[model samples]
Target chain A: MPEMYFSDAIRAALDEALTRDASVVLMGEDIGPYGGAFGITRGLHEKYGPERIIETPISENGFVGVAVGAAMTGLRPVVEIMFMDFILLAADQIINHAAKLHYIYDGQVKVPLVIRAPAGAGRGYGASHSQNLENVFLSVAGLKIVCPATPADAKGLLAAAIRDPNPVLFIEPKALYGARGEVPEGDYTVPLGVARLAREGKDLSIITYGACVPLALAAAGELSEGGLEADVLDLRTLKPMDLTALEATVAKTGRCIVLEEGPLTGGIGAEVSARIGERCFRALKAGVQRVAAQDTPIPSATPLEHAVLPSVAALLAAADRLFE
Target chain B: MPEERLLSAYRKMLLIRLMEERIGALFTEGAIAGTCHLCIGQEAVAVGVAEALELGDEVVSCHRGHGHLLAMGGEPARLLGELMGRQIGYCRGRGGSQHLSAPGIGLLGTNGITGGGIPIATGAALSAHLLRTGAAIVCFFGDGATNQGVFHESLNMAALWSLPVLYVCENNRYAMSEPVCRTVAGGDILARPRAYGISAECVDGMDVEAVEAAARRALAPLRAGKGPAFIEAATYRFCGHSKSDKLLYRTREEEAKWRERDPLTLTRLKLEKAGWKETLPWIEEEVRRQIAEAEEACRRSPLTPPETALQGVYADA
Candidate 1:
């Protein structure tokens, strides 16, 4: 294993898929020559050529729907939306067509398309560009949502997403793209609906995913200093969620705090916590708590954005409050 | 041979008209659950374009898509079963009239949203190009869909990438109750595609032969992978937009004027003048028999069990 940026890990997974399958294609705005808005797909166009690495116009609705159609026929298309907020433009294609095509057609068609969108609010991109829309897609039944916290999981999860015979929404935390971690070299796939233990503990469980994983782990380390050990769980796949792992973790610790980057109301945290209450209520030492962003648009100013989003300090405080 | 081709197109169109009428009758009888958008008068566009398609060619149809599905060799019993919400339906009763798909016959699906299928059809063309399948894609949309942003975006992308897609806009002079003239800018719908640099043709959709000829010419360049093409079929929907529509938007005189140039009547007269008078009766008898069988099949197909409702939401999840 070698330490690599999360962005590089994604690129490596895409490169492996492209090499393995001739039908695998990359389509997105500025994903070819410009490499991508975040520079993740850099040099792929040169290596894979124009046919495989398609540079699309600023048409999210057009290109996303095209990916769905391409997937329906024979090709395995991985469409990249510049930002998670931009997925709103392509919602009909993703939610209505891509998600329902296989089921509505009674399993006649397979929409093997991966929609990669960079989400989360941290870099002061304003309300429009920096909102986490994963919760918006959680209600959509057929589509799978994967948000990787570690570089290794990012590579493995993305590889699996490309190979899966269904539509997958790969949400990359924009804040974590440059974060470095050890990723395996060769073919590896992190199965969807599986959770990874970021840190082992017995006091309580810090249930989280995506960019919040590191923050939860950091908060767990701080809590350990105060003689309280917490289990930090990284839920790689959000949809078809790893409730088995959740049960195990909750049964072990008997207390939990679900963390997310999106707004508090009707967010992923609410769903996870509700499930925890329903399934693991007998084991719970305390009610399931949710530490998430305030119900307000992510702002352009750094101070205001920090106030709106959940911070590592906030998680540490929440953990301390849980013990109290 | 020419007469046979014309007759085949005519038969498909007649099947659509009859099937839509039957579905409407079923809805009135409260046998059909969901509402339907009928393609009664605008049959020529679907029949003509479907006539031009080669085997394995795909189509993405819009909300008013019964005609397109029927023209693409869709099974009457399965389609009727779908509207009746039975297990034997094309979508197994999950998707009703607004969302019908028969991939076996190369129809992707009838989309529920306006202009939603345009990009999906473009993607199918992209797939054909990438897979070297040599199959073309025909996207059927309505006049209302032209206002959607994806319509313009899909056409621009298809043209720019040389995708093998023929965008067929059934400009039936109305978008639901709203007239197209008032909704669309400049009121010249054909100019939309021409602005995208894609070759566009305005065809008389009441004349199946004219539409078929226009489709053949438009599809030639598309099948050859030269580029995308657009055909604005000037047609009219004889019925109200949907089962809920009260027909309050337009005048009876306006409707009467369009009815005089009805596609079925136009095709019947053309066939009669071409000495194919006997063909109409024979075709009508065959269609009537098929419709009867389809109705029986619909009655026989069972409803899906409540326990299995959650199945097929995700495969191998």
Candidate 2:
């Protein structure tokens, strides 16, 4: 085991994917010499050269569609849409073209394209740059959405996403880029659609993912101090959302809280809460409690930004309500 | 060009024209379910451009794409079956006329969304370039697509990476009701690619030989691994944009003017001048018979079962 930053883990995963498969190419703006906006692709470009490490212009729709096309023909193209907010520019390609190709073309083509985007709040990048759009893509049928919360999961999930036959939207939490964690040495992969139980408990379940994983874990730890043990599950992948695991956890613990950093409306938290209400309703527990950002644009100011986004304190409060 | 190839191209264009006209009638008769975009007048561009393509070359087409499939040697029976929602259709009846993909013939797809195929074509080109597949891509789109952001982005990528792509812009002058002049700035469709440093040319789309010559010239450099090229085929659609269009935006005089340069008639004149005096009627009769047989087969094809709609969303995912 080795301690690595989330960014380094992602870099390692990309390196492995490119080295293992000659068809795997990374395309995005400022991904080559500049090493991307967050520097996740720093030295990979030097190792892979210009063809594999393609630095595209500010053409999100163009490159994303190109990735779809390339994936269909022969190559596996991983497109880095610098920010999650910018995925809107490429939505038509992702939703209308890439997502529906398999179904519409009747499985004649497989779109093995991965669109890597940094998502989540609390970076003070304001409304445009910071926001989690995994929930938005969850509605799309054929695409897979992966939101990894830890360094180990980041490396594993990214590797799996690249190898998956269908298109996968890999949303990296920007706030967790520099967070360090113990990652396995070589050939690591966490299967998509499986929930990672960060900390298991018998009293209550705190279901969360991406940036909110740490906050829920911290809240669960704090709740333990107050004589309550909370089960913290990190939903590594959102679309193929480990519902079987979620039902099992919710059935055992009975009490559950859905935690996320995005807005409360139509968020993944809502979906989790609704599913818990539907599947685990017979298990003795209070209603599902959700802790999420207020329904508003993430402001640039530090205090305001922190106020709108979910905090450890908020998760603690929301978890306490699950027992109440 | 030899007489046989010329006659074959002319016959293909005629087939497309007849097929489109029959599809229009079928829609009116309530036989075809969904709306259709007929490329009745722009047959030459499809026939000529497709004539330049080889076996492995792929074409990404726009919504108005029956002509593209026909020009690429697509069977009319399968295409009409697609329109009629038969199981033997290219997409197995799920994708109506707008989404026609013949992977066997390398027809990538026909997108309903405007300008959606440009980047896909670029990616296909990149795939060829990376894998040394020796395959070129031809992207067929309308003039309205020139205003799209993806159009500019794809062209820039094609130029930057020197992808083996030929961007064929069928400037049919109107996107739905809005004329290219009214919508696109400066109304110079070819200038957009020329500004992107791609070798661009505006060809007489109504003339099959001119379009063929231009496409050949563009594909030469593209085949040699040089970069992407653009050809803006100045053409028109005699019918409305879609089944919903009322044709109120453009006057009858303009339509009459474009109809005079009908691609089939232009090709007929070429064949007549080449001393094939008896060829036009014979070709027309052959195309008519072929289409009728295709329609008969299409009518005989079975409709897809409604329960199998959810069958092919993912492949063992």
lDDT of 2 by residue, B1-317 (tens): 68888898999999999999999999999999988999999999999999899989999998999999999999999999999988778987888989989889989999999999999999999999999989989999999999998999999999989999999999999988999879899878878998989999999999998999999999999999999999999999999999888899999999999999999888888889999979789878888999999999988889988988977676565
- Model 2 residue B17 lDDT? 92
**What is the Cα-based lDDT of residue A302 in candidate 1?**
96
TM-score of every candidate:
0.98, 0.98
Q: What pairs collide in candidate 1? A: none
Give the 10-residue window scoring lowest on summed lDDT in candidate 1 chain B: B308-317
Q: Is the docking of candidate 2 incorrect, acceptable, medium or high quality?
A: medium
Per-residue lDDT of A186-297 in model 2, one digit per residue for the tens?
Answer: 8999998899899989999989899888998888888999998988899898987899989988998998889898889999988998888888899947888888999998
Model 1 bad stretches (over 4 Å): none
Could you tell me the lDDT of residue A321 within candidate 1? 68
What's the true lDDT of residue A146 in model 1? 98
Across all candidates, what is each one's fraction of true contacts kept? 0.75, 0.82
